[model samples]
Target: MNIDEDTSAWLGCPTPLEMYKHQCAMLEDELTTAYQLLKKARANIAGLVQMNDLLATEKAAAESQLRSVSADLSRVHVQGSEMSKQIMSLKIIASQNEHLHIENQRLLLELSVLRGPRS
Candidate 1:
């Protein structure tokens, strides 16, 4: 081949092979990093799944406790209602007793007046 000036100049030009090798090495590191990241992500997802199951169990327990509380409240309300009725009945009985007492006192006074010495 004849050593043309243009050919010599082009042959002396620097190719980017070194840069490409560096980039390939960087890409390999990045791929390993990504794989590690994926592994961590999978572990986190598994933990999240376990946490979700635990939360579901806790929710069921809380629901059961709420039902028990509601039943207790209902029972207490019924007992309160019965107590209120009993109080009203007692008040009525007390009023009747007061009226009877007043009548008995008035009768006693009338009897005493009639028994006054006949002058």
Candidate 2:
């Protein structure tokens, strides 16, 4: 149909040209909002990546420190075990010394008895 007949058919309706322009403006506004959202999302993603990298570095350092501490604890345990062995040895030697001293005292008494009464 002719433009006038089509226009006349829809009484009080917006012209096709006006409707298209309105839809285009709405679409442009939506696109602008979407672009802004995308920029914000990208910035957030970048910040998250940097934080993740920092956390990973910190975790590695903590693990290294833990390993060092574990090694130190193992060394301390070994030293403690050695010290315990040495203490046991010392105890045994002290017991032997006590036994020898008693035996020597008994022998001295026997020697005096064998000599009889002194003038």
Cα-based lDDT for every prediction: 0.93, 0.95
- Lowest summed lDDT across 10 adjacent residues in model 1 is found at 5-14
Clash count list over all predictions: 0, 0
Q: RMSD in angstroms, all models?
A: 4.7, 5.4
Local accuracy of candidate 2 as per-residue lDDT tens digits, 1-119: 55555554468777789899999999999999999999999999999999999999999999999999999999999999999999999999999999999999999999999998899
Candidate 1: tens digits of C-alpha lDDT, residues 1-119: 76554553366754578668888999999999999999999999999999999999999999999999999999999999999999999999999999999999999899989899667
Off by over 4 Å in 1: 1-14, 117-119
lDDT of 2 at 33: 100
User: How many backbone collisions does model 1 have?
Assistant: 0
